[model samples]
Target chain A: MAKSRVLVVGTGGIGTMAAYALEKGGLAEATAVMRSNYDAAIKNGIDIDSVQWGQVKAWRPTAITKNVPDVSKGDVAPFDYILVTTKNIPDVPPTVADIISPAVTPGKTAIVLSQNGINIEKPLIARFPTTPVISSVAYTGATETAHAKIYNDDPDCQKIGAFTSPQVPAATAAEAAKRYVNIYNPTGTLDVLYDADVAKVRWRKIAYNGSMNPIASILRMDTPRMRMSRHIIDDLIIPIILEVRAIAEASGVTLQSDLVDVVIHQDPSDTGFKPSMCQDLEKGNLMEIENLVGEPVREAERLGVPAPTLKIVYGILKGLQLRVKEEKGLWEAKFQSGNSYE
Target chain B: MAKSRVLVVGTGGIGTMAAYALEKGGLAEATAVMRSNYDAAIKNGIDIDSVQWGQVKAWRPTAITKNVPDVSKGDVAPFDYILVTTKNIPDVPPTVADIISPAVTPGKTAIVLSQNGINIEKPLIARFPTTPVISSVAYTGATETAHAKIYNDDPDCQKIGAFTSPQVPAATAAEAAKRYVNIYNPTGTLDVLYDADVAKVRWRKIAYNGSMNPIASILRMDTPRMRMSRHIIDDLIIPIILEVRAIAEASGVTLQSDLVDVVIHQDPSDTGFKPSMCQDLEKGNLMEIENLVGEPVREAERLGVPAPTLKIVYGILKGLQLRVKEEKGLWEAKFQSGNSYE
Candidate 1:
C-alpha cells in the first residue's frame, strides 16, 4: 500500500501541532500549508515546540504558502487527507475551499475539519459536493508561544467523524482516523471516536464553550472563580448553558449533561486557562462570536426558544468585539494623523 | 420667622458640600452629623482640605457623633429640614428612618433626599407616611478630602422638587427649597424647578448614570476614552443607553432627549465626571443597582414592555457585582488562612 499523502492547512498553533503529530506517526507524508509568506518562512526556519512530544527535532515538512499550489511544477501530489485547522472566521472557509478544493479528487480525498463549532461543515459540502468532509470535535487547551512553541494543557484526545451527508467510503474515513491515531500515538492520548451521530459531540462541546468561554471572557475573571461563586453558576452560567442546550436540541443534537458542571467543577487551578474568546479580545482579533454564540442564539430565536441568558452573554461579547474594533480604528487614525503632522 | 434648624446627615463629600452651601447661602442653621465617635476630635483640629467650602471663616457648625446626639437630647430642636446625603444602599433607608423618624413631625418636617437613584423615595414614604419627603437632584460635584475639606467643582446649583404622590404641601416644599437655595447659594448656578413631573428629571439623570457608570467601572477605562471610542460607545455604551431609555419610557418616566446623545456625544474633556457608579465600584460599596436600572426594568416588565437591552446590562452588572463579592471573599479567606498558618 502506498503511504497516504496528507496536506495540513493552516500553520497556526493547532495546525502545526497536528502536522507534527502526523509526521511523527509515520502513517503519511505530511505537508504544512500556511496562508502567509511570512508564515511559510517561519515554519521552515523556526523550531515548533511541542507540549506532548518534546520539540519535533526542528523538522521541516514541505511548506506551501498560496492556496492553489502550482500543479504544473510537479512539486505537489494530490492529498489523500486534507485536515483543515483554521479558526472559524469569515475568510477561513473560503480560503480552505480555494486551497484544498483542487486536491480533493472524488473517493480519494477526505477533508477533516478540526476547528471548534458547527455549521462550517455544510458550507464545505456545498463548496465541494463530492469531497468527503469529516467534522471533528477538538477539545484541548493549547497556546502558541512565538512561532516555535505549542503548549497543550489538556492533552485530551481529539474526536473525528463524518457529521454531514455526501457519504464517503467508510474505509476512507477509517484510514484517515487510523492515520490520526498513529500520529498522536506517542502522546498516547488520542481517542478518536467515530460516531454516526457526531452532532451530539459537537453540540456537547458547543454547550461547554458557549457557557464557559463567553462568561469567563466578559467577567474578565477566571473559571475557578466562576465555579466557586454559586451566584455566577446559578444566575448566569447555568442559564446560558440551558439556552445553548435548547438550541442544540432544536437542531436535533442531544446533550448528555449540564455544561456548567463539566466546565466549572473541573479544577481550573490546574490549567490557569483563559478561554480563546478572551485571547481574541486581548489580541484585538475578531472573535468567534457569530459561529459560537450568535448563530445558536439566532437559531434559538427561529425555533421560538427564549435564550435570555445566552443573548445577554452574546450581547456583551459582541459589544466587547465592537469596542475592540473602535479602539483599533482610533489607534490607526491617531497613527495616520501623527504621520501627517510629521 | 425663626431660622429653620436642619440636621445634615452623612458628613461625607455630598453632605459636607451641601452643609457648606447651605451655610454660605443662609438658608438654614445646619448641624453636621457623623456616624463615627471621633467627630469632635476631628472637628476641633480641623483640616482645611477636609472642609467642602475650602478654607472657611467662622460659621463652624456643631459636630455630633451618633452616640452623643441620640435624637432625645433635650436641646435638640425638631429639624425643619433633614438633608440625607448618605450612600444609597439597602441599609440607608432603615438607618435614616431609625435616627430621624422621631424628629419628623407631620406637616412641619421635610426630608430632602440628596442621594443617588430613585428607589429610596418609595421606601421612605412607606416608612414615614406623614413626614414630607422631597427628592432633590444635585449637579455640583464635590469630594471630601482629609477632615474638613470639601471641594466643589464648578457647579453650585441643585434641583429640588416634590416628585412623588401624597404630595407634600406646596408651600412647605417651597419653603424647604428656598432655604436650601439660600444655604447652598452655590456659586456656579442654581435652579429650582417645581414641576410635579420631577420624575422626568430623575429618570434623565438615571439614564445618563445607568449608561455610563457600570461600563466605566467594569472596563476601568476613563470616560473620555469610552466616549471617543466607537467600539465602546456603539457596542457597550449605546446598547446600555437604549435599554435605559426603554425601561424609563416603560416605567412612565419621560426622558429629555435620548441617553445615547447625552452619554456618547457629550464632550470628552468634561471635568470631575467619573461615573458615580464607577466610584461606588471602586469603594466596594453596594451599587445603587435596584434604583438605577433594576427597579425601572422591573417596572417595565410590570407594564408589559420588554426591555431587552436593559435586561442584558442589568445581568452583566449583576454578574460583576457577584464577581466582586466572590473576589472579596477569596481575598478574606486567603488573608485568614495566612494568619492561621503564621
Candidate 2:
C-alpha cells in the first residue's frame, strides 16, 4: 500500500516539527513548501534539537519545493493533509489561505491547522469551503533555535479536533478529523488526541498561551524564570489564566478545572525555549497579539465580562508590535510617558 | 514679621513645582531639602519653566539644606509645612515618616503628603501621631527638566484635603488643612480645595495615576502620544482606571465617574514631559511600583475584588525596577527575556 502523503506549509518551528512528526510516525510521506528558506532547507535540510525527536543535524525530506505548483511532481497526487504551521500574525504578506489554498484538492485534501488561539480555522474553512479542517492544539514549548533547526521543550501530546464552526458541518469535520488522527497517532510520537469538542480544547490551550506567551515576551523571560519567581507567577501568571478562564466561561465554552495548572505545571527543561511572541518581537517579525490576547478579551468584553488584565496585556503586546513595525519603517506610531507619575 | 517657612522635601518635579508655588504665593518662605543636587540648588536656585509661573531663570529660596536636623535654624522653629514629593517605593530606606519626622513638631508643623495612591500617610501618622497631616492631590503634569528646573504641562490646581485616617482626627486634620490651604491658595498660585474626605480625593487621583504612570513607564510614552492612539488609551488606559475605580469602590471609597476621563483629556504641553516612572527607569532610579500599583492592587485582591490590570502593570514595573536595581549594584533581581517571543 502506498503511504499517506502530507504537505507542510511555512517552515518555521511548527512546520518543521510537523514534517518531522510525519516522518517519525512512519506511516506518511511529508513535503514542505518554503519560500525564502527554500534553498537553505533543500541544501541544509532541517536541523531540529528536540528531546522527543533527538538531534537531527540535517533533516532532508523526500520532496521540498517553494510554491503549490511544485509541491509534488507529476500528475497531482492530491495531498491527504496540508498542515499549516506559520505564526498567526495579522496584517502581513502571504496569508494562510492564499498560500495553501491552490494545492488543496476539493475532497482529498484536509487542512490540519496546528495553530494557537481560538476561531482560527474559520478563514481556511471559508476559503476552502468543501475541504475538511482539523484544528491542532500543539502543546509543546517549541522554537526555531537556528535558521532551520527547531527546539522543543516540554514536549506533550498534540490535541486534534474537528473544527465545527458555523461554516463546517459536524459529520464532515468528524470524518476528516478521524483520518487526520490516524495519520498523527501511529507510533504514539507525541500522542495526538482527537477531541470531539475542538473549541474547548483550543480555549484550554489558550489559557496557557495567552498568559505565558505575551508575558514572557514583555518581561523578556522564559518559563523557567517564571517558575523561579513565585510571587510574579502566582501574582501575575495565574491571574492572567483566571482572566482567560473568565473569557472562556463568558463565551460559553466550559474549560476544565485543571486548566489553570497548564501554566503552573511545566518541565524545567522547557525553560530554555522562548515563546513565539517574544521571538516575533526580537526577530522584528509581526506578532499575533490580536489572536492570542485581543480577540478573546474582546469576546469577554462583548459579553459584559470584566477582562481588564487581558486587555492591558493585549495593549502592551500590541504596543510592542507597533514599535517593531515602526522600526521596520512600515508605519509611524509614537507616544511619550508624559511624566504622569511624578 | 518673618514669613512662615515651608520645607519641600525630595526635590524632583513635584518638589521643584511646590517650591515655585510657595514662592509665588508670597505667604511663606520656601526651603528645599536637596541631597543629590544641594550644590546645584544653592548655586542656581530653582529654575522653572511652568505655564503658571512663566519662566524663572534663577529663583532662590530662603534656604536650601540637606538633612532634617538642619531644616530650621537654632530657634528650633518647626517647618510650617514639610511637603514630601518623593516616590513612595517599598522595601527601601528612609520611609515617609523617617525622612520627615525630625523636622515635624507636635502641634506646629503640618506635613502635607503630596503623593498618589491609597493609605500613604499611615507611616507618617504612626511616627508623628500628634503632628497634623494634609493630603495634596497635585493635578499638574510636571517633570524635572533640569536639576532644579521643572516643566509643568497643566499647572491647574492642587487639591488640599484634610487627611482623616485612623491616626488623624477629623478636627485636627481639618484645622491643619485650613492652614495649609491658606499657604497653598494665597494669591491663587494654584487652586487648592480643602476636601473634607481626603481618602475619596486620593482614590480619584489613583484612577489617573495607576493607569498612566506605570503604563507610560513600560511603553516609554508621554501623554500626547497616548492621545494619538484612541484605541490604545480606550482599550488600555480607561480599563486600568476602571479597575482602580473598582478597587476604590470595593474599599468603600467611591470614585467619580469622570475619573477615567482624567486620562483622556490632556494638555499638549504635557506630551514632552516624562512620567516619574519613565524618568526613574531612564535615570536608573528606584520606582514606586509598590505604593502606586502593588498596594492598591493588593488591597483590591484582599477584599475579594479583581484588580488584574493593576497587578500585571505592577509586575512589569517591578520587573523593570528589579532590572534597574540589579544594574545599579544594589542586589540580585534578574531575569532574561529568553527570546521567548522569538
CA lDDT of each prediction against the hidden true structure: 0.64, 0.74
Give the per-residue lDDT of model 2 (tens digit) for B232-324.
Answer: 687678778888888788888887766766555643434365566777777778887777788898888889887666777887776666657
lDDT by residue (A97-136, candidate 1, tens digit) is 6656666766567788887776767777778776767776
- The DockQ figures for the candidates are 0.16, 0.22
lDDT tens readout by residue for model 2, A1-342: 577889888777777777777777777888877787787777877888887778887787767877765334546678888888787765555778887867888777888988787777767878887788888888666677666767875564688877764655788889888777777677554567778878788888788788888877876666665666666677667878888888788878888787766456643433355677777777777888877887787788788887667777888877677667677887664544443321
Roughly what TM-score does model 1 have, to 2 decimal places? 0.74
Cα lDDT of model 1 by residue, B1-342, tens digit:
566677788776677766665665554677777654245435463333422345653336654445324444556667777888876656224555665666566666778888767666887777777666777777666666555555555454467776453656556665666555555553534453344456777877776777677677666555665654565666567776776677667777666664567556453443334677777677775566767777767777787777666666676677677655555662321211111111
Q: What's the true lDDT of residue A79 in model 2? A: 87
TM-score of 2: 0.81
**Worst ten in a row by lDDT for model 1 chain A:** A333-342
Q: How far in Å is the alpha carbon of B9 misplaced in model 1?
A: 4.4
